[model samples]
Target: MSTVVAQTEEPEFDLVEAALALCGGDAHATITALLDELRFVRGQLALSEAGMSVGFTRGWKPRFEIEGDT
Candidate 1:
């Protein structure tokens, strides 16, 4: 039986395709920026609607609430 050789062709990076990809990338970045803005705006809106404010001291709070060792 003859052994088959694998072809090693260089991957094509079309400039037009790459440019289109960058446009999509820009759109994705814009969406992410808008999402972050929305998160901040929605958080502010929620706080305003609830009419609640919280103050924090310059320290870290413990996340571990150990009831007992199992």
Candidate 2:
């Protein structure tokens, strides 16, 4: 009989726990600051994974411009 080795996979990071770590025991501050940072980081990572195709650019301009009648 041959024995097979089992491989173990690591668990994913919990946003709440990471946020708590950043909070340093302050509930309100943690919620606002940590959450904001988490959101920004998540957005950046998502965009990078998507090849950054959906965001805005500085040089983009509308083809038609509206003018007020005098």
Candidate 3:
């Protein structure tokens, strides 16, 4: 008899979490920041086809260093 195996998937960077991390783990800050960033990215997507695509679903990381870092 053969046994079935399950596979595990790696976690992708969450933008909301990253924003919260940037804002010192503040939920309000994360929501506000992510909303603004999302708007800007949506605008870019609408403006041009070559602008590339972005989504909150997954596959992203912090582009800048968090605050209070040396």
**Predicted structure with the largest lDDT when compared to the true one:** 3
For model 3, residues 1-70, the per-residue Cα lDDT tens digits are: 9999899898897976776789999898878888898888766655554443456424443333347857
Report the C-alpha lDDT of model 2 over 1-70, residue by residue, as the tens digit.
Answer: 9999999998998977787777776789887996687778777766655553334544443322246884
Q: At residue 40, give the lDDT of candidate 1.
A: 86
lDDT of each: 0.61, 0.68, 0.69
Scored by lDDT, model 1 comes in at 0.61
Clashing pairs in 2: none
**Model 1 segments beyond 4 Å from truth?**
1-25, 52-70
Error of 3 at 70 (Å): 41
TM-score of 2: 0.35
Runs with alpha carbons beyond 4 Å of true place in candidate 3: 1-17, 49-70
TM-score of each: 0.37, 0.35, 0.44
